[model samples]
Target: MESPATTKDTASRTQRPEGRPGYGQLLRTDGAWSFLLPGFLARQPYAMLTISIVLLVEHTTGSFGLAGAVSATAGIAMALLAPQSGKLADRFGQGAVLVPQVFLHALTIAALITVASTDAPLWSLFVAAVPAGATAPQISPMVRARWAARLQGSPLMTTAAAFESVTDEFTFVVGPVLATALCTGVHPAAGLIAEAAVSLVGGLIFAAQRRTQPASARAGDAPESARSDQARPQSALAVPGARVLVVAVLGIGMVFGGMQVSLTAFTESIGRPGINGLMYGAFAAGNMLAAVAVGAIRWKRGPQTRLLAGYPALVVAAALVAGTAQLDPWVLVLGALGTLTGLCIAPCMITSFTLIETLVPAGARTEAFTWLTGAIALGQATGSTVAGQLADRSGAGAGFLAPFAGTALALVVVLIFRKALHTPHSGLVAARGVGHRTTVTVD
Candidate 1:
């Protein structure tokens, strides 16, 4: 049924003479902009959630401790619930999962705002936060799933990985800054109000892109056996590779968490707390730049090979950062080291995502992505806690050890499970057999 000319065009798109597709080429795909634009907006609130919750709750209750506890509750809820949301999206469809969730999330935000504003019991803020966090759409993972669905076999999948990494970095860098500005400059509740608004509008638009969404295991369409299979419970963690990635990403999360707390401590110790953002910005800029560069290159090595190589590089980078923090502890020195550490982050992140695509079954791809997201979140939380304790007890730069420890743990896992990651080819076969359309990949 395939025409020669059409097939030729597909080949041209997938296997370019340059070997790697550029962002311009990747964006040229039909309907990409539709989901991408709204998805960008939809994902921003995730970054805003912590800062906004902290500011509004603190303003109302006049207690940073209470605000932190309430924010942690939301963070914990989101981390636990996101994978389940992804699983539902896998079964029922993204649109079906997202439509009600966006509205419910918006309503919960409203309720949370009301409770925070009123002289209500502190328990009500916690209660309002759970549903708000639980219902927030996991748009980043959903968009990545869309890219996988659209461009699985193509080299542009590589580009997509890079672009998503950059997008994620951009959102984290911008979102908190925006949220902080709104909370301080405008009103305490203004940041949260904006979060609710964008989440509602952007999530709805993202959900409306039905044509671009990945195929779900809907009941009527699939064979009875397949339907029965879907009925049975499945977790993405059932895949060993998924578990490995969770651990690896958890380490990456620790790196972020460690850096956040350690950097803050370092800045405050020097009495130049204002430059904290600039230091972190240097790190993020390196990550974004590296992601851009990595995506532009063509590689003969598979993701597994690249990942094995990248993780060690990350470990080394983290160690240097740790050493610099403990020894010299100068602003410029740490800034350069932070940038070096960030340069190492994107490749590993891009490869981890690429490997997950290779290794995960399509039926649970979104859930698998969410698991990694959740892992990073958990890692960050743990890293922050440990780093904060260290900063308090051992002085300023000692908190840097947390990131090194995290990277070392990840490296050990990757080296130990190197054999398990080679199952990508078999994973693809398994996914295809399960009624999901998947393309063969060289990796």
Candidate 2:
């Protein structure tokens, strides 16, 4: 007969082999690809179509003021509701939250088309905008959380993130062109219809996946390890470093929003309204290039270091934009400068996202990601509002310079708080030891 101590040791050795798969193994499995494909397809076209219609409405109405207001309203509503939506995902599973939200969003888009076609009052348009904004599904966060659950700690997480960034770039590039084509070539309503169809189909497909479904609501039926994994840091807002990441991304969004208005206004002021597309395209192209480059370059540097390093590039880009106020150069030259200046965007966003992924607990991932999205929306709204007012008061030249100044200010603030924001205890290190260790330390 075996001694009790020997038997206990033997059981421990036997059980160790049954441990959960690491991030690498998860990515290599079929499930990761299945989850990723649906998310990418669903998001890319929706983003493209939505932006196109928003711009088309502004162009058609001949009121940047109304456009700005509508955009701001939608943005503010989305920002406010996004966190709650994330919580809903946590409570009711991503599929349940996402599928219904996508359907509602589709209906909202259809309604907006009707409202735009009629001679509706501005207030009516604003009122319709509320539902449109509020129902904007928390697609990115939900998809990310699903990916985290499936892939855990593998390179798939990085790859999936890079894929998302690339898709965003593709959307910016393709969405505007498609929107413009629809608005100018076909009817503006066609663009709205197309967006609705994409949302409905994509949303439904994503929601149908078995892996994406919520866990069964039975006592003790929950995946014990997964539940405990994310339970600790669900309230990420209280974390100092996470707060800084949100603030930094918000400022970045504001800069981009202002830049959009300023760039258009400047193009029009310089007798090149037709070239607005070219300038914007160039900027997006730069960002795309940077994203691809960064994705290819494997870096061991912490997210903060990457973020801090990228800031000066943005500062230079902003300075260049400010200088464009007086440049009597060819349109192509100006476009090139704008494109080169935009190189920092992808790197900055990627770093911020990676930091959030590393810092926030698994269960709180959706909420934390939603906060980042909300920050971007809020920033864009602020920037657009400020730029529009400045453009009306001064020339578009002055408006174009505004984002540069804002970006410079943001850079300074981020640099000042770099040490606090980049501290080791505040980042991905916190998430690494959850199951393996007894005590998890969060800063």
Candidate 3:
């Protein structure tokens, strides 16, 4: 017979923590919010960077084509570097990877600003963007991977994901507005300088916090690590089905990237150059609302199946954006149109992420998610590159057609190649069951 004390101890050990923790649990269990702050600050600069560069370059060269080419080059560099950066983080740790990259990224921004101020060779302006993008920290992917890791298969993860999407859309929307204001009210170089400062401060703080970083594969800096490339498990990319999903993500990126240049030109064409960020914000607001709505209820369908709806929804959103081009600037019709499209933004992105999570093995969390970021950047680069030329020639309105075409192509891709999205029983259950209570709402 066990002693009373021993029996009591056994019960305490076996009993699990009580109650389901929804949104707030993540913060309470760990100081996640504390670290997320630095990550947010660091990421805000990314939104500022391209717009600031475009403004500076366009002002200096008096050519939107040159500006667009620079943005595209930087974006391409980011797309290629993102996955490699994630791989390093997974092998080493976040601190080692982030700290150095942040410093380098800051330096690159400072150099670009100097060139713009001094009226240095225009070629140098383009050169500066290369390092600016290559050194951009892998913060977003790291944060998402952390959430997925912490949440595991808990139903609350959907809420967490929705929250991430809402916050991200909000930041991207706000970042540009702030950038525009600084450039318009202050000096054009002010935005880039601000971005550098934010990146440095926020990144250092995040790196110092070692408690929350994802576990690395190796113990330390050793030639022979615990897992070698040859011995490692196959990556998420190895799954043939993942090809369609990644390509779809790439298409989405292109649309957003193209829209950025076109929207900037559109504001210029309308003689309200300051309104670019607000327009994007209006669209983002709709996205936030949708994310909130989705988080409130459980879905009856699998996440993969749910993704099919997003492609068409995006198509409608793009068409509406193009439609508003014909409306008078005084109509203020964009807010309603922007919000309408926002309704679909969260659903589309979150579903894609959830599907990726379901398909990828947990070990490759950071790398897999980072690839998503790369795809987005690549698409955006393509958009900005093409749209810049179109805007220079045909006008901003014609450039709006880029996003419409991109999204339309996205829809077609999913329709024809969507068979790969079929999830197994476990993935299906994860979406509908595990904490989801089936409640229907016309989504």
Q: Which model is ahead, 2 or 3, in terms of TM-score? A: 3
Candidates 2 and 3 compared by lDDT, better number:
3
TM match of model 1 to true structure: 0.77
For residues 1-443, write the lDDT of model 1, one tens digit per residue: 44566456555544443433666777876678989999999999987876577668767875544565576567778889987888788789999999999899889999999999998888989899888778878899899889876764565665676678789988867776677668766888988899999999999999989888888876356445546766665677888888898899889888876776677567767887557667867777787788766665555566777788999999999999888887856789899999998899888887787678667776566567778889887776567556666766787788788889998988899899887787646433111111122334543
Q: Which residue segments of model 3 deviate by more than 4 Å?
A: 1-18, 145-160, 220-230, 326-331, 426-443
Q: TM-score of the candidate numbered 2?
A: 0.80
Q: What are the per-residue Cα lDDT tens digits for candidate 3 across 1-443?
A: 54566445433322323345355554553556766787787778767777777777777777777888888888889889888888788778888898989889988988877776786888897788899988877677777656654544444455456556666776767777788778766887787888788878888987887776767766554223324542675677875546667777777776667767877888788888777777766766777677666656557776766789777888788788776764544426755665676676677766777777667665564456667767778877877777788888887776766777777887787789777776543435333322233323332
Best by TM-score: 3
Q: Of models 1 and 2, which has the larger TM-score?
A: 2
Provide the global lDDT of candidate 1 against the true structure.
0.76
User: Higher-lDDT candidate among 1 and 3?
Assistant: 1
Candidate 2 local distance difference test against the native: 0.65
**Candidate 2 error regions (>4 Å):** 1-28, 153-155, 211-221, 229-234, 266-275, 298-301, 326-329, 358-365, 426-443
